[model samples]
Target: MTWTDDDPGQGEPPAILGLAKLRTARAQEIRRAQDTLTTASGDAGVGWQAQSQTAFAAEVQKTAGDVELLAVGMEKQAAVLTQYAGQLSQLKDRQRILEQRRASAKSSLARANAMMPGGLFSEPTPAPFVLAGEEDSTAEAKAEEEARQRAAAESKIAAAQADLRAIESEWDALVADRRRVDQSCSTALEAADILGAVSSFSGSAVSAASPGDLLDRLSVLSAIDLQVLLAAHPELAEKLQAASTQDVATWWNALDAEHQQTFIVGLPNIIGSLNGVSALGRVAANRINAANRLEAIERTLADWKRQAAQPGSFTNATSQISALEDEIKYLRGAVSEPPTVQLYLYDKDADRIIEMIGTPSPETKRVVTYTPGTLANLDGFYSGDTQSIADWLHKRDEDGMVAFVVKDGRYPQNPLTEANDQQYARGIAQNLADFEEVAFTDPLLEGRQSVAIGHSWGVANITVSEALGAHYDKVVSLSGAGAPADWTPSPTTEYRDFSYDDILQFAQDIRVGEHGAVWSGRNPREVGFAHEDYYDAPLTWKSFPGNGLVNPLLAAAGGIESHNLAASTAPGNLTLLNDMRDFINEAGAPR
Candidate 1:
C-alpha cells in the first residue's frame, strides 16, 4: 500500500506528528460511521408493528452497537498514534541536545589527552580513546614531575568519558520511549479489538440467539455463514457446553466429517475442550492446540531472547527461560513420543490433559479412564512415569479395550498441606462428569462398557462425578478419599474400591472425620459398594467395623505405598502388584 501526504486512511500511521494529522482524518471517518450507528440505535428504541419487528429492531441495535465499537477502536488506535508521534518528536529533540553534550565531552576529552606527553590538544576529531597510563616516550621527567604532569589530565579524561557514557545512556532511554508507547497502545487497542473489531467493523450482525438456538439456526445457514459466525463468536459452538451432552453429540455428529475437521482446524483450542466432540476429533484438535501452545512458547522464547540482548535481562528472566525450555521439551515429547498415546483434551487455560492410550472405534468393547491423585501435573505426566499405568493396561488389550490417562488437571499440588481439602474434588466433579459423557458418547464407542478409575483424591473426583450423573458401567477406587458431604452412587452402577489399609487410609479421617458424610465418612470401605476388598486380603475381614485389634503399624508402609500407583510392570510387592494387575484387567473389559 502506498500513502501520499494526503491521508492516513491510505496506509499505516507514520512515525511523525505531521503524519498523525492523517490518522486524525481516519478517526474522523470512523466517527461518521459511529454517528450513523448511534442514530440507527435510537430509532430501534421505538415501537414497530410486525411479528418480526422486535427481531429486526434487535438486529439494528446490535449492528449499530458493533459499528460504534469499531469506531471507538479505530479512534483509540488513532489517538495512540498521535500521542506516540508527539512523544517521538520530543524524544528526537532531546536526542539532538544529548548529541551536542556528547560532542563537547569528546572535545574536552581530546584536550585532556593533549596534557599527556604524546597527545595533541589541537586535534579536530578526538583521537581514538587510549588508556591514561601509557608511557609517552616524549616525557623525560622525574617520577614526581611525571605524576604531577599526568594527575589532573587523568581526572579530566575520566570525567569526559563518564559524561560521554551518561549522554549515550540518556539517548538510548529517550529513543526507547517509542517502543514503550507502541507496546502500551497495542495492548489497549487489542482490548478494544475484542469488542468485535474484525467482525463488527463491517457493521454486520448475526442472531443474538443462544447456543442451543444456534443449533436450529445452523441447519438453515450455509457453511460460509457458519464460518462467519464462528469467526466472529467462537463461543457460539462453545456455548453448547451448557446443553445436554447427548444433544450436543447428536448435533455435532450430524455435521459433515469435513466440516467437523474444518471447525477443529479453525479453532482447535476451543473445540478441543468442548464436550460432545468425538474422541478422534478432540484428539486431532487437541494436538493442534498443543502445537499452538508450543508455537506460543516459541514466540515468547524469541521475545525473551530479544530482551536478553540488553544487560541484566538474562539475570532477571533466566528462570522464565528455563520454564519455557522445559515446557518445549515436554510438549515436543508429548506430541511425538509414546506413539500409543493420543491427545484427547489439552486445555491450556485449565492446565489439563487427557491422553488416550488407544483409539476407540465402533468395535471397541471396553474403555477406561484413569484419574490421578494429588500433586499430579503436566511435568509429572509428560516427563515422569505417569503414562506407564495407561500403557500397561493398553498393552494387555487382546480384544478391544481403550485406556486413557487423565494425566494432568487443576488438582492440588501440595499433598501435606492439602490432605484435608476436599473442595478440589467437588469443584471438578461436574467437569469430569461432562467430560466422560461427551468424550465417550460417539457412535464408535456407544455400546462399549465404561470404567471410571481413580486413585487417592481422584477417587473422590470420580465418585462425585458419578453423583453428578456421569454414567459408568463400573467404578474402581485405589486408596479412595471422601466424596462431598451428601454423596450417593447410582444403584445401577457397580462399584469396587481397594485400599491397602495404610497410613494414607488413616489420612481420610482428616476429611471424613472433620467433615461428616451422610452416614459414614468418605471412606470407600464405609460407602456402599457391590464388591469392595483390600489388596492384601487379610485373614480376618472383621467387616473392618467391629471392635478388634487394628494394627496401623502393619499397614502403615504398604498403605502409603498404595495411595500412589506403581504400575504392574514397576518394581513393588510381586503379590500385590500381580493382584492389582489382575484387578485392572477385570475392571477394564466386558464381564
Candidate 2:
C-alpha cells in the first residue's frame, strides 16, 4: 500500500489493488500449469492413457496461455489506474498550495490595514492639531493637506484589499478544478477496474497471431467473404463504425497506399458508406467505386453499340445507347481530372459533396455552404455561376477563406414534381447537418463561422435542417419556396431575399395555399419569424429604362427571370450578393 512516484501500484484504490493481486495469483497459476504440462509432455508414457493425458495436457497449456494474456492486460489496467491516481494526488497538492497562498494574502491585507494610520474602514478626517495665534488661512491649508494624505492612504488600502480578493477568487477556482480532477480520477479508477474484469471474459482473445497476419488475410478477402464476415460478426463492424474519426484516420494512414487501395476496393460498399470512417478514407473508397462504375457503364455502352449495328435488331438500342451515354458523361464529369476545387464527402450515388473553393481548415475565418435549388445535379454543380459566386466571396474578403458547397439532395428525375415534398427537404437537411457535424469535428474547422445559403428548394432544405437543430451562424434564403407549418429557423441570424417581380414567390404562394388549402406549409417570407433582415430585389428588366416603353409587355418575362437573378452571377444579382455578404459579416462580428 506504500505510495511512490515510480510505483505502478502507488495511490491505486482498493478495488484496483484487489484486481492486481488476483492478476498476480492467476499469473502464478498459469506458470505452474505450463510447467506441469511441459513435464507431462516430455515423460515417456505407454498404453491408451498416454494419448488422453497428452490431449489433456495440451488443453491445459492452451487455457494457461489465455489466462496469462488476460493477466497481462489486467496488469496494464492497474498501471493506468495508478497513473490517474497520481495525477489526482498532484492536483490536490496544487489545490492546497493555492489555498495557502490565498490565506497568506488575506493575512497580509489584515496586517496592512493595521499598519495604516486610522483603520482601513475609517473615513478620512482633518488633523486635530491647530497652531495657536495662527491665521485661519494657515489652519485651513493644514487641514486640506491632511485630508488629501488621508484620501491617498485610503486608496492604497482599497487597492490592497482588491488584490487580496482577486487572489481569493483565483484560489476558489483552483479548488473547484481540483475537485473535478479528483472526481475524474476516481471515475477512471473505477472504469479501469470494471473493464479489467470484463476483459478477462470478453472473448477478445485471438490465437497468438500477429496483427499483420490478420491484415494480410483481410487484404485478400473477396467481397462476398467480407460481407459474410460482416454478417457473422456485426458487433465488430459496429465497433468500427462507431470509432472516432481521428482513430479511423489513423488506422487508414498506417496502411501503405497499395494495401489501402486493395482493401477498400475489395469492400467498397462497406468502406464507402460506413459511418465514422474518415472523410479521407471515404473519398478514396468512393473514387474507386466511381471508377469501377464508369468502367462497367462503358463496357455496357460498347456492347449496346455493337448490338445496334447488328442486322435485324428489333430492340431500340438507340435510346438505350443515348441514356447510357448521358450517364457516362455525368459520371465522368463528377470524377473528372483536374478538379476545380477541393472535394470532400463525394458520393456518386447521392451526388453530394462537401466541397470547398477555399480551404475550410482552422485557419479559415469563415466557411459558407451553398445549397442549390431544383434541377441541381453533379453535372451542373460547378457551373460558371457557382464558381463566380465563390470567387466573389473570396475576393470580397481577402483575409477570410470562403467555400461554396452544392450539397444536392436526392430528387426525382423530374425535380418540379418533388419541389414541394417536405420529406425530400428533411432528408437533404439531415445530410447537410451530418456533413456539418463531420466538418466541425475537424480540429482545423472548430469554432469557425458557418453560413448556409439556400436557393429555391435549397431554402426549404436549409430551413428544415435548422429547425431540426442544425447549427449555423447565419442562413440566407434566396427566393425560398416555403417551409413546414410547425417549423421555425433555429435561433440564429437569418436573412431572406425575394424579388418584387419574381413570379416564383407568387407561384409558391399558390402552392402553399397562402393566397387560396396550405399547399406546402408556410412561405418563409410570411412566417412572421423574426428574421435579422430581408432584402427586396427590384424586378426591373435587365435593360431597364431602355425597355421601359415595352416593359409592361415583358413584365411576366422579367419576373420569371428575376426568380433566378438573386442567386445568379448576373450583374443585377451583385447587389443581392453584396447585401448577403454584409449580413454575414455583421452576424459574425464580435458582440
RMSD of each: 18.9, 26.0
Clashes of each: 1, 2
User: TM-score for each prediction?
Assistant: 0.57, 0.50
List the candidate 1 regions with Cα displacement exceeding 4 Å. Answer: 1-207, 212-244, 302-319, 333-341, 407-409, 414-419, 508-520, 529-562, 565-569, 573-577, 584-591
Predicted candidate 1 versus true structure: per-residue lDDT over 470-585, tens digit per residue: 77877776676656656777666667666655455566554555564321366776676544455553322232323345664443444455545433234543455455456655
List the lowest-lDDT window of 10 residues for candidate 1.
3-12
lDDT of 2 by residue, 340-412 (tens): 3444555656666555566544467777778777776755553445445566777778557656576645643
